[model samples]
Target: MKKSILTFSLAVSLLACSYAQNIVDGNKIPVAGNVKISLPQGFTTAIVAENLGKPRHLTINPDGSMYVKLARAVDSKGVLYLKDTNADGKYEVIKGFGNYGGTGIYTKNGYLYTSSNQEVFRYKLNANNEVADTEHPEKIITGLKMGRQHETKSIVIDNNDNIYVNIGAYSNSCQQEDRKPGSLGVPGCPLLDSAGGIWQFKANKLNQSYGQGTRYATGLRNVVGLDWNNTTNSLFVMQHGRDQLNTLFPDLFDAKTNAELPAECMYELKKGDNAGWPFAYYDPFQKKNMLAPEYGGDGKKAADASYINPVVAFPAHLAPNGLLFYTGSQFPEKYRNGAFIAFHGSWNRAPEKQEGFFVAFVPFKNGKPSGNWEFFANGFAGSDNITSASQAVYRPCGLAQGPDGSIYVTDDKKGTIFKISYNGK
Candidate 1:
């Protein structure tokens, strides 16, 4: 019996060694040092978290735990929690707080901060990354303009501990009345004064109030995907471009050109960066930026000096909802510095057959885009015919990399968190 036990131990050790060797070798799978990554065969997705009430975004703690943000429509009272009860790469419910609102949640310097349509707040977190006490939520800023159009609130922090909140303009394109073209923009566009930009505030201070050393940047329409790029040590965002092309202007843009034109933009934002929204869009097909229809362009010429070109542009109406730069070493070397974008799919590309319902990968070298992106993962649509929105089972809205190097993708439409890992067996 003792001999049999010793053999079992030896077998276990050998198995562990095999896994280690596989991981070391898997790091070299992408031979070209490009964006192409081959997934290991027999790999399956597991649910590491669930029932997260329209989970919108997620961030990882240093210790492999995650803090997720949920949309207000599902739970009007506040957010929910999931703690890894067994430490087996999954989280179990531990605690929750807040009232129903479209706010972003993130952890920095032992504090968990959240933002609502009108205010930004923070709370103290325990060692486990869970809310230790919600006795009160420290209001960081207030008086942020909120409206129906582009109202989903999002927040992020920089290495300097400066908190940034996105206040989206209520109007579609700052039209004279809102969504109407050829109409003069409101002088100075009051929305620019209170919304349509990133507002900076002191993250460590409480009740310090709004409009104090705030106003870090301006001229952003609706930046839902915002993060501090560790590679460049700067803030980056993906903007959902203006919609209803051609229909809003037929003489300038036709159906096919409008469908594949205006590229969804990814910006490396800095102080005083103005990406033309109501004025222009980056046209990927023409391979040159073009002026927005509202400002009057024949869709052939580009307004060079008016707006900054995107570092990366994708197919229009793809609705890039989430962006993450992989810094973890769990994946292959080629993917170590690349960016992952979750496109919530196209709605306006109808009749031409909707597109962009999958996650895409953009290769990055030394903090800049190396080349055009490619579809990294497919089969999310779960069907061949996407005639209507109801037929889609998954619409990826959030992305997070686990401590173990597994990728977590959240489907807002179905409230599912898919954990993708390598097996290499």
Candidate 2:
């Protein structure tokens, strides 16, 4: 027994020595004294901003300035700010305004667009990236719908300058009462009328009304992360899949499969693209699209052809909260025109393990995924263990690429912003 114990101790010591050398050589970032993982060479991480109150989304202007949106507060509604105080490629919070809460923020032709629960609004930005016209808080669109299930109002714009907003459904899996499984859906799901899809409106028009414009897409549970792909000239959205299969329907999904089965999806969306939600979810384990328990699909079979397959599918509950296509020359040539997704990590995979607290990269060739995805960054959980949800320090919820080719990630949990830049050493 003494010999065996001594042998194990010696092996561990050697491993620790090798890990320390790797960190000293700048080959990896040490998560702890004994463990480290590789990052891109000469790429350094720095905190650009901290102590924000749930900074959800970010956008960059024609100049080097940035605009950020905050969500929910006890006293104030929310604030949108312009940050360019230092001119060092970091936001210093120069000025801010807005009394309403919103997530989606974009600037086009001097107008800054944002959304509240049931409406979309705009403000004019000046030469310094500050709100120049506060009185022109035009309510562009109003009175769509809002509820607890998918209340985040994510908005985007296309090259032609049309505006799009993802108004999400108000239930989990179309349950009779939010997340309770096997509860039959409402006869036609009244929430479908005003919610559960993307709506399009004129970007320059004011006082635009909802329920009067065209439904761009339907059957989307919630599309929080959306961006217009310039190469394909199409919009892509990353969806948050539903949860708790076996706990709600033990007759169908086994506990292990339930924990790690469904494929969080990325879709190449055009007008009228119908992604299956509530009725189905993609099962990565089975390597096929499977019907949801509420819809009567067994664990291994794909649903009917009425539902569209995802262009790319990721592991369950990664919570892909942001998507951006890299359009800069600062990084290596391999990363241009690729997609970066900010995974907010998992919460429902409890007692099994959590996943996806890091950013991932998927290279694109001719507007499609050219290869398998890779973990571009890690260590956001603050530890390797993911057994509990609250232990995570930084959950990546948003992404933005600056004009100088640096990438920024925002964490909603701690409200921190990290700027990643290549040092070109």
Candidate 3:
């Protein structure tokens, strides 16, 4: 067979030159360079692209190209479109098209959008903005109501064309049977009317459904990171805090206060803003907003006053997912507009060693949140004693920002895509 196809094309060109000689001085990447991350002083990381399968939300391309979004499909496509063509920041061509999966992606104006836990599409781009009918997208919003524990929609877009979307809350505490440990909670949580919160629609309208969008913010209990913070024009989200909690109040939380009492918020929203899930939660050790033992709370109580609190919180189950907001400029100046967040770590926080798979930072100034939110990129769960989540090896989820001010992250476990840059030492 022609010498076994020339010995399998010379063993795939010597395994692509031993994976490009594992980059050395130039593109870094020894495990996403800066040696297992810990960025801050002069920054520096790489890896660019790797496996890529479950890569959730991502966006970019004003010309830099990225457009990810995939919680499933790959050969059946779920939108990929990488492109770097030798700029050396990595990417190298790649491509895929949309079919339907879920996670939520964005672009705006020229259009690109994405989503699928039950609909919300849109493509049309061309003129170099890429994606112009990658197999006809356009569904703009449909059904949307899938659940079994926070369905993973995660979308965002605002500049007035609107389009939010999040719909989680399938019951972790709205109880009455959901997390049935001591059960109870169900006085008002009518599943928050239709799955937790944040809805809003009409990004050029189209198929629209699920009561034609509008919820815009209600007791959010599962917002895999959202964005649209045009310097505080609003809409920020992150919430994913509400799980077990001492396996359902074992006589008022224990097991290390259920691995550190509730927290993991971030809010910022508006147009109704609720924040309190299943009655209330945010308790970074009584920073307050409590009352959630299925609504009778025994662990210190508090809530009421229509809930609302979190403008920051963090540190309970980690699992943030992704949310950017830097606004480019290549870095420095205290990361311009600030706010990165990508967590995606704890799978229930076992005995507690596993923390957010990292990529945090906050800092925003005139739009709120300034100072103290640190951890600009830490090691993506390559392991810090993660007792579970399949032993963890990269799980930061998704986040983008490159135009020059590099910061791409994505890594739904083994799908890589790092980046990080800074250099001005």
| TM-scores for candidates 1 onward, in order | 0.85, 0.88, 0.37
> How much lDDT does candidate 1 score?
0.69
RMSD of 1: 14.0
**Full-model lDDT for every candidate:** 0.69, 0.75, 0.77
TM-score of 3: 0.37
Tell me the lDDT of model 3 at 259.
61
Residue lDDT tens for model 1, 268-313: 8887777766666777645566766566665655865856678887
Best by lDDT: 3
Worst 10 residues of 3 by lDDT: 19-28
Candidate 2 residue 36 Cα shift, in angstroms, is 8.9
| Candidate 2 residue lDDT tens string, 88-181 | 7456766566777778878778788888777888887777666777655888888868887678888888988789899888887887766775
Q: Count the backbone clashes (under 3 Å) in each candidate.
A: 5, 0, 1
RMSD of each: 14.0, 7.4, 20.2
Please report, as a residue range, the 10-residue window in candidate 1 with the lowest summed lDDT.
23-32
What C-alpha lDDT does candidate 3 achieve relative to the native structure? 0.77
- Which residue pairs clash in candidate 3? 330-405
Q: Which model is ahead, 1 or 2, in terms of TM-score?
A: 2
